[model samples]
Target: MIFSAGDGKESEPSTPLPPPYSGHNHVGDIEFHEILAGTDNFDESLVIGRGGFGKVYKGCINHGENLVVSAIKRLDPESSQGASEFWSEVQMLSRLRHCNIVSLIGYCTHEQEKILVYEYMPNGTLSDHLHKQGTPLSWFRRLNICIGAGLGLRYLHNDVGIDSGVIHRDFKSSNILLNESWESKISDFGLSKTCPTNQLSTHVNTLVKGTFGYLDPNYFRTGKLTRKSDVYAFGVVLLEVLCGKPALEELVDGEWRNLATWAQDSIKEGNLKNIIDSDIMGEISPKCLRKFVKMTERCLHDNTEQRPTMDAVVVTLKSVLALQEKLSMQAAGSRTIFGRMVDLLPFPTNGENSGRVEHNTLAPSKHGDGIVVAVKMLTSKTRQAYDKRQTKHIAELAHPNINIGGIFECRDSKHKYFNQLLFPNRGNFAEPLSWGTRLMIMIGVARGLTYLHLNKVHCDIRPSNILLDEEFNAKLEGITKTVTKETHISTWVRETMYYMAPEYFWNGDLSMKSDIYSFGVVLLESMTGRKAWVYGHIEKASLVDWASTVKSRIIYLKEIMDPRLNHNYPLQGAFECFDLVLRCIANESKDRPSSKEVLQTLERIYALNK
Candidate 1:
C-alpha cells in the first residue's frame, strides 16, 4: 500500500501531468477537479503539519470585507496515495455533522488536485502539549482533552442527527486538535465506516482498511473493526496522558511497544515510581494515580467486550475528575503528605443508594413514533438479572434510531438485588403484529443493527430476540442479562453458526465478519418472513436455503417480503433493499462490505429517491 518516488518505488500515473510538476509527487491513479477556480489564497506560512497523506495548511476564506480562517488540507499531488486520501476524506466527512467533530467547510477538486478546508484550531493538537515543544499543559487541561474527545466520539456513535454512525479509525493524540481555550475536536474521518441502513444489499463484503500504530490489534489480525477497537486506541491515548509518553515508543531495549503494557508490567513488579512522568510526580496523589491507572487498564484489556464503551469512559473520567477536585480542595489546608493521604479517601455520594432505573414512554402515535422505554425497575427480577453488565453500555446508547431507551442502577433494598433493568418489556413478544406494522419493524431492525454493525458492536442477532415496539422499531433484545459461564462460549458459537460464513462455521472462529454473515441471514428473514432456525421442523431447514429457493420466486420484491406487511411495501426502496440482501448473503464473507461502506451505499440510494 506504500508508494514512494524517492525510493524508486513509484508507478506511472494514468494521465499526463500539467506543467510545473517538477519535484511534485504524482498520485498513481487519483484525480481531482478544483471547486475554487482561479483562486490563489493558499498561504505557505500557515502550513501546520505533514504526514504520508499530505500537508495541512492554515488558510482564510474571504467574503467581501469579512474573513474566516480555516485549515486547508491539500494533497501533495506527489504523495502517490494523496488522491485516495482526498476522496476518502470527502466521501466520509461530507455525511457527518457533530459538535465534537471538526467541520469540513468546503473542498476544492480541480486539475487533478484535491484540497479540503476545515475550521482552524488556534491552540493546535494534543500532540503539541504532550510531545511537541510548548507550554506544558496542566493535568486538569489534559483531563479536559480526554473528555472532549470522548464526547465527540460519543456523538459520532450515537447522535442520529446525521445519516449514520461514524467510527474514526485513526484515533490518537495527533488526530485530536485543540482550538482557542483548548477545546478538542476530532479532525479526520477518511478511514471511517457507516453501516448500511437497508439490509437488502451487497455492500457487506468490503475489506478492512486502517492505520498502523493506532489500529486495533484484534481488527488488524481479524479484519473486524468494532467499537471496542476504537476503545482500545482511546485506551492507548489515555495511557499516554497518564504516563506522559506515546503509546508506542522506543525503550531502553531499543524495541517499540505500547506504554499500556509497559506501565502495567511496571505496576505488577512494584515499580510504579519509575513509570509516572517526573514533572507531575509529587503533585499527583496515589489515590488519583490508582483510579487513573485502573480506568486505563480497563480500556486496554485484551477482550473487546471487557473494554468500557466511550460513554462509560467519559463517565469514569468525570468521576475521576470529581474525586481529584475533592482531593485538591481538601489538600489546600494539609500540612503533610500523610495528612493528604488520610483525607484522600473516595467521598461517597450524599444519596442513601445510587440512582435506580426508571422507565418513560412516548404516547402511542404515528409510524415510528411510539417507543416503550426500558426502565431498569429495581423490584423486577428481570431488571436485577440485566444489571450484571455495566451501566455505561446502556445510558450512552441513545439515537433517534437506536432502541436502548435508558439504563440506570440503584442500591435500594428492592432494587439492590438486581444488577440492571431494561425498558418496556424484557424478551417477551407474543403480541401479534399487524401487517402494516411489520414493514416499520423491518426498517427499525435495519436501523438498530446498522448502528451496532457500523459502531462495531455486534449484538447476538436472532429472530426470537428481535423485539418490536408500538411503532415497530425493532429492538435487539436479550442483551440486558448476564451470560452464565458454561453457556457463554457455546452460545456465541451457535449464534455464529446460525448465520456464520461457511469457512468460519467450519473452522469455529468468531469475528466481525461473522456479524456480516449474521446480518445477511437476518436480511433474508426480514424479506421472506421466516425464522433463521426452527425448533421442531422435520426438514431442519436453514433460513439461507429457504431464501435461495425463493430467490427466483421473488418476481417483485414485495412478493417475497414479510407477509406481516401484507405485501404493501414501498416498491423501489424495498426492491433495492432486497438486492442488498442478496449481496449480503453471498457465500463469501470477503464479498461483504463493511457496515460503513454499506451505510454510504444506502445513503446514496436514499438520496437518489428522496
Candidate 2:
C-alpha cells in the first residue's frame, strides 16, 4: 500500500510500486503513521540530529516478532532536498549492502512527508567522537575506523557489480557513523554519483558540490570528478584523526588556515612532530608514524594519477596497525626504570649531537623527580676533557639556555655519562622553524653567548650545538675555550669550517667577534632553511654569498624565506630580522654588532611583532 504524494494525510493506493523502486519493500502508509505517532508531528525529545535535509528522530518499531530501533530522517517540505533527493537516498542505500556501509532498515513516503529509516547507531557520528571533546580515541582505534571507511569505499568503487561504479562525493568525518561496539560505517549518500563505466572516458564532467574544506581542489577547479576526488577528502579525514583538529581553523589574527595545506608543508619540511596531536605523543611508534603520514601525503597529491586506490590505502593501514601492535607488545615487555618503561626506538639521525646521543625514557617520580632523558655516551678520547669542562661549567654557570645534562655514575662500570631531558614532540633545528620560533631561538642563543663571552669564549657555535626544549627554547651545548692574553688560533680553525668567520678561515684569529660571525650564519640558515655551505649545486657556494647577491634587492626576500612558513609571518619583523642577520654576518670583524647588540635587536623585533 502507498500514500498519495499531495496531501498531508495517509491513504492506501490501488496501483503497483513504481518501476524505479519495484523490487524494494514499500512500508504500508498506516504502519508508518503508527510508528511516527501521527502525520508531521514529531516529538522534540526524540530529535537526535538536524541537517540541511531536515530533522532526524529516534523511534522504535516492531519488525516481525522483534522490536527494532531505527533513525528516521524526516525531510522538511521547504528544504532544498525535495522528491529527487528522497528517491536518490532510497535507491542508493537499498542497492548497496556491506558490513562497512550503513544498513537501510526501511523507508516511508506518506503523502507530502518523505522519510528514510536506518539501523540506529547508538554511538553517534565519527565527527562527534573526534572533535566534540569526548573521550579521546586511541591511535589503534582511530586507525581501525579509517580502515573500515576505506573498505566501504573499495566495495563501492571496485566490488559492486553495477556498470557505473559509485563515488562518494561527500566523504568526510561527519558522514562516518559509529556503532555501539565502535564499528564504523559510512553514511549519507545525498551527493554521491555513479562514475560512467565507458572504457574510453576516465572521468565524469559534472557540477561540483561538496563541503568546503574537504572538496578536491582539482574537481573544484575543473568541474571534473573522479574516484580520486573521494580520496582527497579522505586524506583530510586522516589528518583530522592524526592532529585532532578541524579541517580549517581561524587564527587569533582572523585568518582561516587550511589543515591540509599546513600539514603537507609541515611533513615536507620534516616537522610532522610539531603538528601531531599531543595526546598521541609517545604512543605512536616512529616507523608507524612515518608510514601513516606518507600514506596520507600520497592521498592528498594534486595529481589524480599519483593517488593510490582505496584498496592500496586499506592494505597500508592494516600494515601500520600491525606495526603499532608489535611495538605495543614490545613495550609491554621492555625494561622499566623507576616506574616507566623505556622505548627502545633510536633517535632520528638529523638531531644527533655527535654520534653518542640516544633516546631514552625515564619514569616520573615525586613532585621534583626527573623526566625522560636522552643519554649521551662520551668517547674515551674526549671523556676526560668533557668531564672536566662540564663539571666546572655545570657548577659555576646556570642559565635557561645552557645544556646541563645531569651526570649519571654507574657502579658496575668505570664510566660516568650525562643525560638530557628529551623533547619527544619536537625535532632538531635541521627541520624547519616557524618565524616566531626562529626569533625566540635566536634571542636565547644570543643570551647564552652573551653569558659565555663575559667570562669564557665559545669556540664552537652552530645549529647542531643548539638544542631546543619541548617548548622550543634554545639551549647552548658543546665546549667553550678560556680567553687569555695568548690567542689559540689553530684550535679554533679545526672546528666546523662553514660557520667560521672569514678572518679565522684566512688566518687564525680567535675573538668574540668570530663567535658573532657564526651566529650570523646560523641566523641566515634559520631564516632561509638552507645550510651554510651548499654542496653539489655549485662549488664553494656559501649561503652568505647567496644571500648577499640577493640582499641588495629587497624584492628577492620572498625567494629566500623559508617555504615551510607559507608566508604566514609578520612582514615588518622579517625585514628587521634580515637586516640584523646581515649586520652580524659582515666580512670585517669590526663591522659586525656585538652579541649584546644582537640580543637587544632581536628583543625589540619580537616586541614589535607581539
Candidate 3:
C-alpha cells in the first residue's frame, strides 16, 4: 500500500467506482489523436504548467464549431505513477461536481500515452497569484479563496463521502486553480485515495504523498493517510495565503525546512508583524488577524488527533471571514479620518463615543444633539465623480429605518473640499438578536427599501449596507450613491453579486424587484443565521439556491432555520417568513414580489406576532 516517490511502482485507482458511475467511467475518454491535434502536437509553447505527472497544455476539447478550451495534463511515459494517478483523477473528478471542485472534461488513453482534460482555468493556480507577485490579492479576496477551498474539502470529507470519501493527498496552492471569475477550484486528484464509509476507522495505511512543504508531518512519519492529512496540508496553504509567501521547501543552516514549520515558529515567538505580509499588515483588523492566526495554529498542530475535521475548519474560516468583513466596514476608534473632516461648529467633535453608540459607530443627528456623528471622508477621486443632484436628494431624505443623515461640502481657505458624509450609529446584523427582533429588523429594512423605491432611489443592498441601532432597528445605507462606477470597476459589483436578482446579475437590467430580491437574501440571512453566499461546497453555493430546494418541505425548512433560535420561535411565523423569502428570490423578476409587497408581507408577519 506504500506508494513512495520514485519507487518504480505504478499508481492506480484506490477504489473501483460502483453502480451509476460504473457505466459513465468511460464517458470522458477521448481519442489520443484529438488531444495532440488540439494541443498542436503537445506543443511546448502551449504548456501552461508542469508537474510530477507531466506537462499541462492549454488545448481545445473539440474541433470546429464544437470546440472548447481545456487544460490537458499528459502523463509522461517515464512517470512511475502515471497510470495509477491518471485513473484516480479521471474517476474522482468525473463524478464529483461541486463549486469548489474542478471539473474533469475528458481523458485519452492511447498506447504508451495518458492525458486528462480539465475545464480551463483562465486565472491559473492560487500559488501564481499569492506568491508569484503576479497580482496582489486584497485581504477580502484572500479570505474568499480560502473559504472556497475549505468548502470543497468539506464536501469531500463530509457530504460526498456517504459511501466513500476522498483524501486529496496533494491539496496544495498550485493544485488549486482559479477560473475566469477568480473562483477557486481544487484540482489534481492524482494522489487522491478513496476510503470506505462503513469502516470503523477512516485511515488508510499507505505511503505518504503530497507536496514537500505541504506534506502532513504525522502522515509522513507514520504513513497513516486520513482526511486529517489533507487538513494539515491545507493549514500550510492558509499560512501561505496569510503571510503571502510560498510554502516551498527552504534550506536554512544546512537543514531543509518546511514553510509551515518556519512560519509556525515565528508565530509561536509572538512575531506576528514579522510574519505578516507587509502589503496586507495594515489591512487586516486586529480581531481578524488574531482569529486567523489561532485557526492556522490549530491546523498545524502536530498531534493528528488534535487536528480539526474539514467541516469544523470550514465553519471556523467562515466566521473569520465574517469578522474581517464586519470590522473593515465598521472600523472605529480611528482619529485620522476625523482630522481630515470639516465638522460644523454646532455638532462639535467629542473625541469619544457617547457610550450609547453601539458597535462604536455614531449617526447623524440635529445640529447640536451631542451624538458624535459617524463621518466618512470622501476621497478627491470619488468626490470628483459624485452625481450632485443625487447627492442632494439622498441628503434631504429622513426616515427612521434609513441611516443616511447628510453630506456636508465645506471647503478650507485653500478651496480644497472637506466633504463629510454623516450616518447614524453603524453596526452589522447583531448575533444576539432574537428571532422576533430579526424579523422586526427585516420589516424595518423592507420599509426603508419601499420608501427608497417609491422615491426612485437606486442602490446596492447587502448585509454590510444595512445598519442596526441599539434596539436592533434596521436602516438601509448605500442610498446616496452606487459607486459601481468609482470602485475597481468589478470589485463592488462582484461583492454585491450574492444578493443580486438573476435578471440584474446576468443582464444590465435593474428594477424595483432587484432591491426586493436583495431584501429577500438579507431576510434569508436573518432567518437561517447563514451568510448570503457560501462558496466552499458546490451544492450550497448560494443560500438562496440551497434554501429554495427545501422551501416546499416543512421538515427541511426547520433544519435550515437559525440554530441559535433553538427551535424556540413560533413555527407558523418562521414558515411564513421562509415562504416570503422564496417569493422574493423568484428567478424571474416578474415572479418576484415588489418592494411594497415585501414590506406588506413583513408587516403581516409582525402583525401576526402581536
> Largest lDDT belongs to which candidate?
2
Candidate 2 clashing pairs, residues 3+ apart or interchain: none
| RMSD (Å) of each candidate, 1 decimal | 26.7, 15.4, 20.7
Better of 2 and 3 by lDDT: 2
Task: For candidate 2, give the lDDT of residue 91.
Answer: 72
**lDDT measured at residue 15 in model 3 versus the true structure, 0 to 100:** 42
Q: Name the best candidate (by TM-score).
A: 2
* Candidate 3 per-residue C-alpha lDDT over 224-316 given as tens digits, one digit per residue, 9 for 90 to 100: 788888998889999988877778644444666567877888656434444666556556754566678778888888987888888788898
Measured by C-alpha RMSD in angstroms, how accurate is candidate 3?
20.7
Q: What's the TM-score of every candidate structure?
A: 0.47, 0.55, 0.54
Could you arrange the candidates by lDDT from highest to lowest? 2, 3, 1
- Which stretches of candidate 2 lie above 4 Å from their native place? 1-19, 22-30, 38-41, 196-201, 337-610
lDDT of 1: 0.56
lDDT of 2: 0.69
The digit string of per-residue lDDT tens for model 1 on 303-368 reads 777888788989988887776676665444222111111111122122122233212211111111
Q: Which should have the higher lDDT, number 1 or number 3?
A: 3
**How many clashing residue pairs appear in each of the predictions shown?**
37, 0, 7
